[model samples]
Target: MRLAPGRAILTLDLALKLALVVLLLLAVVFPDWEQFEGKAIGTRILTYPLSGLLVPAGWWLFFRGRPYPFAADVVVILPFVIDTAGNAANLYNSIWWWDDANHFVNWGLLTAAFLLVVRPLRLSWWNLLTLGIGFGAATAIAWEVLEYFAFIRNSPELETAYTDTLGDLVLGLCGSTAASGLMAVGYQHRELPARS
Candidate 1:
């Protein structure tokens, strides 16, 4: 099945994701920005950027779009609003790494997403899992590529880069799985009313 075909309107999550992608590309395409910031960029990112910009962005995105009643809107938003933000935090590399915490939480979110989209729509589980995992894996690779290029210019240690990349993939898979589960469970129950 295909996503609803329409102009892709702007979302807060979309904005943050776009910013992260742009930031990585900018640094990779031009590595001098690392020193230009005098390492203060890292501190500023941890202290402010993630909380100030990214959180608001995710909150906006999570509530921006309208999804079907009893659908897995919350589940699908879980990745962008919750898990992906955590990933972005790690990318800044300024604070404690929480991939371990994000790992299973993302999986649960993905599971909810899966239930939301596929289950209610009568789509096959196999197809849902495949597509979700494929998307997550692709993004994971893209994030790694971004990081690798950034480090190439920033002159970070290779081992650190490798670890970061690995962490990204692991979390990506977890998020994907949780989203898929959400699709699986979406609209399956007619038991309760959703929040207004």
Candidate 2:
């Protein structure tokens, strides 16, 4: 029997994660000494995941007729959207990549992810705060690792690698913090206890 779109998405998402593990091997390219600057790291990190997600996401968007689980919707959508756009900007680094704009863009996205996750997780105020910070930091580190070693690994002139990685972490934190704050405030008025 044919799988439903939702099921197909789940399968595809998992497959993408696995595929990422494989493509990570390509990270050890011959180094370029220059141009490995900060925020540029964010650009690199965003590339594969965005591309990995886009095809399946696009397919699902067309095939699925029913509404998604709320948390699932946010989890799936925002990352794909922001990452795709951000990485696209990276393609034209000589043209489209803007640092300040990228920071705010990522911050906005991470915040959205954090808030969305909180509602679904039904995190308490304290947990929400912890998760936001924790998630932000974790993703930032992972993204940096990917940037420094993976796609841009061959660059010898990585002046901004560390700086950009730092910026991405900061922006991610801002996003996560914003999300947790929204969740905490929203929970105060909400009667539903989203306990798992």
Candidate 3:
């Protein structure tokens, strides 16, 4: 059976959040779990529940009155689930490039979600693309800075990794571009109706 759009997102969002709770339980109960090692207390708290929660909270507080959140919102939250799962399953360092993949994909989803939420603007296609790219770049930079201050500064290895920062920014750029293209195609095809 087909579910309503909003119901589907709510279900998926709830399931993912519950999964994170389970992952957090594992992390706390079995500190020796390979995935739990080397994770700072602040980092775990931020990544596991706090940061991961803001998307749904933002949706409920700001966007729930709409017919439903754009599917892109659900897409936006998918990365949190993926990232949390990777960490909980010990895949971050185990599988090389996992972090990089997350950065690329998450930024793309976020960019898309932002555009969808603000689609009422009726901006020119060019302007929308510019907005998405700018938003993605700014977010990536902000995240990198947060990482630096929150956890990276304490670790000598992360402090020296300028290339990773640059790489992440590049990925964000690419992701934003991709999201813009996706939105553009949707608008062009009339899949996304302009508000008002």
Candidate 4:
């Protein structure tokens, strides 16, 4: 099947554009910026818009030539946006389970996106499931390690707790597995012969 952009991609692009405009306006007009307070310029940029852009950026970098479904794009972009926005609003700090929930949902989304990317390969169900879950789990662990080195290591507020890291990894694994199962079922349904 030939790949093409659809309403979903257009809508995602529009939302991203709107986010960019909002970020710019805040940068220009918001004095005593709550989100950026006491944050380094580099960290501020990475935390807000840059962090939010990673999903679409990954799409451009890795999957631009492929034909991805609109739902796949939505699956990837929405949770990451929510996670970034939640972080900006300090929801992670306020709600104890918010971080865990984001980890589960966002990693699930990532796994689904990866499965969609590889759909054209026509891998076996088990292989597809393994790839999706493994990739998502590895990526989740890598992200936690990156966080430890970048923001968590030296911070007085954040600690590199073994339990927390393990919990995040477990949540990521669960999410990835769930997404992989859904992909398998969807593929099975699509493959079934249609009734006349």
Candidate 5:
């Protein structure tokens, strides 16, 4: 049968969260798992649980008594799921385009989640676009810095790291700009909440 849209989204969010949990457990329990090694395992151990915490954190911070933001939660959780799964499957190395796609799509997902969470604020189009893109760009830069310090500094990947970092940043900006622009346009006609 079919599920309602919110229910379906909730289901998907739960499933993704479950997958992350399983990945986290594997990382902790079997740090030598064939699918991940060295820094990869450490990354998973650090990232997975933190990724899972975002939804509840957002709820506690922003959506306390309101309806659960399942769709927003999915948007927030999906990129981490995709990244972790890709690593587990070794797709980032095997599929030449996977990393590129992740850079673009994950940034888009993050920006979209930010917009969704803030929708009730009824900000103007310009404000939404600015904040969304700013958040995305800042995150993209932070992620690159993390990579540099975490693993890329000493790895063979450092040889092409400059170019790769530039491209990833550009892709992330494009993705976020696109998502923010679209969201701004869509919300342009809605009246902003009146200031007191």
Candidate 6:
């Protein structure tokens, strides 16, 4: 049997969310797991579930009784899943470019998700660009702050933290800008909602 497009996307989204939960649980249960050794398990345990719930919560809060945008849900949940999976697989250590790519791609995913969530607002292209980039920049800064406190502050990685943080922030903002530009252009013609 074949699922409808929305159903298929929703299925994928649910799968990613489940993977995220399982990964978190494994990290908690086996703190000695390769990636768990020097990582921020506590912060992840607290935040990952909340991050996973964001799309569902937004749907309930903003579009109750309407079909939640499954594609958007997948987009929003993917970054968290990818991040967790990367850590679980030890890609960040085994692969030199994993961390950099994660920052860039995750920010792009986040900015795209933000655009999709606010589409009902019928905001102008410029407004979308401004808001999306601003949101991405803000989140990147917040993430760096969290990283500093969670691991960098006391870790041997502290020596290179400054350069790494700066690079991550720049890559994240670039990703956000690229996603915002694509989304803005795609929606330029439909900036205003049609009258009934």
Question: Candidate 5, residues 103-152: lDDT per residue as tens digits?
Answer: 99999999998898888777989999999999999999999998888888
Per residue, candidate 2 scores C-alpha lDDT tens digits across 19-95 of: 45343323324123223333353444456466445434644665345344433444544454444344333532554
The predicted structure with the larger TM-score, 1 or 2, is 2
lDDT of 6: 0.89
Candidate ranking (lDDT, best to worst): 6, 5, 3, 4, 2, 1
Leading candidate by TM-score = 6
Error of 3 at 145 (Å): 0.5
Residue range 61-105, candidate 1, lDDT tens digits: 553454432224334444444433443334434445554555546
> What clash count goes with each model?
27, 14, 0, 0, 0, 0
Q: After superposition, how far is residue 52 of candidate 3 from its true place, in Å?
A: 5.6
Better of 2 and 4 by lDDT: 4
Error of 4 at 34 (Å): 5.9
List the candidate 5 regions with Cα displacement exceeding 4 Å. Answer: 24-35, 189-196
lDDT of 1: 0.49
User: In candidate 3, what are the lDDT values of residues 1-196, reduced to their tens digit?
Assistant: 9989677778887776777767667667777776766556446655657645565577677767655554654666666667667888788879888878888888888898888766766776777778888888898899888777776666765755688788988987888788887877667667457689
TM-score of each: 0.43, 0.54, 0.81, 0.75, 0.87, 0.92
Best by lDDT: 6
